[model samples]
Target: MTIDDHKSHLITLGKFLKQFQTSNSVMNSDIPGNNKFFEEMNQKIDSAIHHNGWFTRENIIFALQQWSEALTPRNLKLWLGEYDLSESGDKTVGIVMAGNIPLVGFHDFLSVLVSGHKVLVKLSTNDRQLLPVIASYLMHLDSRYENRIRFTDNRMKDFDAVIATGSNNTARYFEYYFKDKPSIIRKNRNSVAIITGNETKEELEKLSEDIFRYYGLGCRNVSKLYVPENYDFDSFFKAMYKWNPIINQDKYANNYDYNKAVYLMSEFKLLDNGFLMLKEDESFGSPIATLFYEKYQDEKELKDRLKENEEKIQCIVKKESNTNEVTFGQTQKPQLWDYADNIDTIDFLSKL
Candidate 1:
């Protein structure tokens, strides 16, 4: 499709999303009868939880809005560039979806759609419902999209290119399997932070959203902290305590217990007032209920270390530091201009 065509497609999808948000009465039902979209989203969220018993509807909506905003025509054109519909098309693109977190595969889906390529999406069992629902909604807005999209339980070998998302371990298998084809295989990654100055309670609360949202399963979730020596942990914990409701969910509680017990048995000193854990380490990523960290005093040394570790950190949340723009709960929520690995999707598709 041409750039115009891609833009039109996104506008149509956005309209459909807006309509869905308007017409559906079950979107965000968690907050009582708030808004139609929220209610509908809440229903889907509830169903997803009932089916998988893993994520909350709020997190799912948060992710959906993030993608929807990113895929807006203005943002898409900026990040993906204008599509060239006149260019020769690739045969098909095989997308292996990852279900470790909700809607993690949508960016690739948007790329396939805007590029006018046939997409054969192998849905992750953990996220089998949302994609189909989204596809159905898109088809309602533009039936043309229907012919280009396909969901399959079985893998087919005929494809011009592939994009697979998985853990660092599974990426090796994907590399071997799709090595002959042009592909982008994503391995596991986690985000981190550098705390230098005093943070307001609001900022810390928002940071807590990034830390606890989706139960720390997402790549953008901050799993590690870099704080100055003798930093007062009490202030940070006091600010973060507002989100204690996050632990109320049974699933999150289970994760907390499992990890906390393991740490205790291993003789790890948890920075806890009976809720969360903070440990000191060099790694950026950690499992739920625990955090890893390193102490830094010199700003130059911290910046150098962060630069060295850039490849491993998807995001670095910092206060009064020289780095990328930092936001609190918005870690997982990327804008349209935020290109993944700084690669322009449309440019890549056009080349293909």
Candidate 2:
């Protein structure tokens, strides 16, 4: 099949995804064989929470809605326009996916297939349920994908190149294992936000989403904060009130209790809001239900420090702090082109 053929299959899968969605889903009669697929997906979604507590209904739907909005004909064309896929002949691309968030590795999977390469994927045990169903729907859309898509729980072999995402230790293993081939090895990274003390309740409220979304498990979630020295956190804590409901999640509340106990026992100062804790710390990887904050002397010095530690960060979120700042509240809503770690997956696949 040609590149357009591959795209057409994904477009159909996106349409099928829309039928089960709550927000972006529509009653499109044109999406073929969606009745069975839609009902089946609904069952899987209902059971997803049992499989992985992090796969909440709302978060799963959010992931589906993002994909549905992204896989449109126009969006796909715009994303793929920069590359010459016609000359990008087929190769076998092995992918080791991360299960931090639902469909976390779908982009790499999509990139490999859309760029005319066969994909051999090892699904994260935490994310084992969803992608395979979507892959099956794609194969149903066109049987050609059956030849191109494969999944393995065992050791992987017989692939030209590899793309793996994991912790820093696993990343080192990937580097050594795939040293003989072209590869993209991803490591642990966290996101941070810079507050200028001028943000509106609306912006801070949205920033809360960046913090609470997916229980702050995603690399894009804002795990740290940079605030001007002597900045009052009254408004910041007030805006975060919306996510107070997250404290009801058992896993999150346990972490909150444990982290708060650790802080109290150690005599570390903290500002608590019943649900979330704001602790003055220098680390980027904050615990769930807690956000680490540090005071910045000025923009220049803070940006310099951030620049010096760019490798540890995934995205910088702010209202107007820097040129590359991702607008507040958009950390988890990255577009199709927002490459992880700014490494171009499509470009990597195209080269393979």
Candidate 3:
């Protein structure tokens, strides 16, 4: 199919996604195939929550809402405008999806298809319920999509290249197995925020979304913080209180209680405000219900250190934007062009 044909189908998919932007799935008769697909999509949302404890209705809807907002005609045009897709080749690209959050592997799926390639998907068992229904929606949009998308439960084969996302351990296996093929093997990466102690309470409150959304499971979540030495957390703690209800969720509460007990028994120093705990740590990845922080004495030295360790970091959130730094609250709300790991997915696909 032509590039315009692909864009037309995607824009329709985006409109279908708009109906589920909230937990209350309102029917939009203007969207095509709503009579057949809308109710089924709503049922699958609940099924996703049933299958995965972390897939709460609120977070699932939030993710859908973000995608609905992103898949506009303007966004599609702007993102694809830079590329020359007319020369794009048709290859079967194998995708190994990660299930940390709902639809986490979708961008790779979209990239392969939009850039004129067939996709062979291996869905993460935790997230198997959602994307198939989405693929069904696209197939409804156009029968041609049926030939473009394939989901496999068994071993993957007959693909010229691959894009895989996993933990550091699985990354090693992917690197070794896909050695001879063209690939993008992603490893564990975490985001961090820089608190200069000058942030407004409003800004910090927005920052809380970056910390607690999807219970901080996604790579875009800010798992660590860098604050000035002797930084008073009184305001920060007060701002975070908005999400106190997050602890009421059984899974999150269990993690909070268990992590707290371990810290107390080990006699490790911690900062607690009922729901979340903060500890001074040098690492980037922090466990759920806990946010690791380090005191920075010099901005220049810390920036240099962060630049030195760019591979381990996914995003650097700050009050000011410089190069790749995302503003507070926008980490999870990446635009179409904001590629993961600064690696251009479309550029990778165009030449394949």
Candidate 4:
């Protein structure tokens, strides 16, 4: 199929996804096989939750909705506008996906296909359900996708290039394993938010979304805070109160209880709101149910430190902070152009 046809098929697939989100149940105006597709995807959602404790319904829905928004023709074209797809040829790009958050590796998968390359996806055991069903949907939209996508649980082989994401330990293995191939091996990274006492309650409330969404499983979630010395957290805690229901989940509750106990036993000072805890820490990889924070002497000093640790950060958030800094609470709602690790997957795939 031609590149435009390929793009149209994905756009249809996106429209199909929009039909299945929680709040919107209505079928699109004209889509064949909608009933069966919706039913099957719903079943996959249930299976995914049963397979992984962290795949809660809310998190899955948020992920699906974001992809639906991203799959529009405008977004797909805008994201790929700079690249030339004139020489469409088949090359297999192997992807080792991460299960940290739902569909976290989809951008890489999309990059491979839109660049006119075949994809061999090795799904994370923790995320075994969602992508295959989506792949089935894509193939149903157009038979060409059937030849374009493949998934395997066994060791991956016969791929020209690779993209893998995992913790720092697994990252070393990936770097060594794919050393002979053109590859992108990602390491653990966490996001942080900078607070200046000037933030309004509304902005803090939005920031709570960045912290609690996906239950802090995503790298984009704000696991650390950079605040001025003597920063008062009273207002921030009040804003975070709305997410108290998150603690009601058994897994989250257990983490909160366990982490809180560890901190107390170690005599570490903490700020707790019964659901989430904040501690003064120099690290970015905060424990689930906890947020680490550090005092910054001033904005300039914080920016300097952030620059020094740029590789460890996925995104930095601040309220009208600067051109590069994300607005408060927008960390998770990334656009198609917001490449992970500041790496352009399309450019990587295109040049291959």
The prediction achieving the highest TM-score against the true structure is 3
Looking at model 3, the pairs that clash are: none
TM-score per candidate: 0.87, 0.96, 0.99, 0.97
What TM-score does candidate 1 get on C-alpha atoms?
0.87
Model 3: per-residue lDDT, tens digit, 268-293?
Answer: 99999999999999999999999999
In lDDT terms, which candidate is top? 3
Count of clashing pairs, candidate 2: 0
The residue pairs in collision within model 4 are none
* Model 4 CA deviation exceeding 4 Å by range: none
Ranking of candidates on lDDT, top first: 3, 4, 2, 1
Worst 10 residues of 1 by lDDT: 25-34
lDDT of 4: 0.89
Per-residue lDDT for 1-352 in model 4, tens only?
6768877887887877777665546776687557668878888988999999988887898888888888888988888787777674588999999998889988888888888899999999989899998888888888888999999989999999999999999999999999999998899999999998999999999999999999999999999999988999999999999999998999999999999999999999999989999999999999999999999887887899899999999989988857667988788888888889999888788778
Q: Which regions in candidate 2 have their CA more than 4 angstroms from the true location?
A: 22-28, 321-323
What does each candidate score in C-alpha RMSD? 4.3, 1.7, 0.8, 1.3
Candidate 2's displacement at residue 220, Å, is 0.2
Give the TM-score comparing model 3 with the true structure, all chains together: 0.99
- Local error of candidate 4 at 263, Å? 0.5
Can you write out model 2's per-residue Cα lDDT over 1-352, one digit (the tens) per residue?
8878877877887777766665444556778877657767877787776899878889999888788878889888888888987767579999999998989999999999888889999999898888888888888888888999999999899999999999999999999999998999999999999999999999999899899989999999999999998999999999999888898889889999999999999999999999888899988999888889999888888989999999999999998545556988888888888899889998888777
- Model 2 Cα RMSD, Å? 1.7
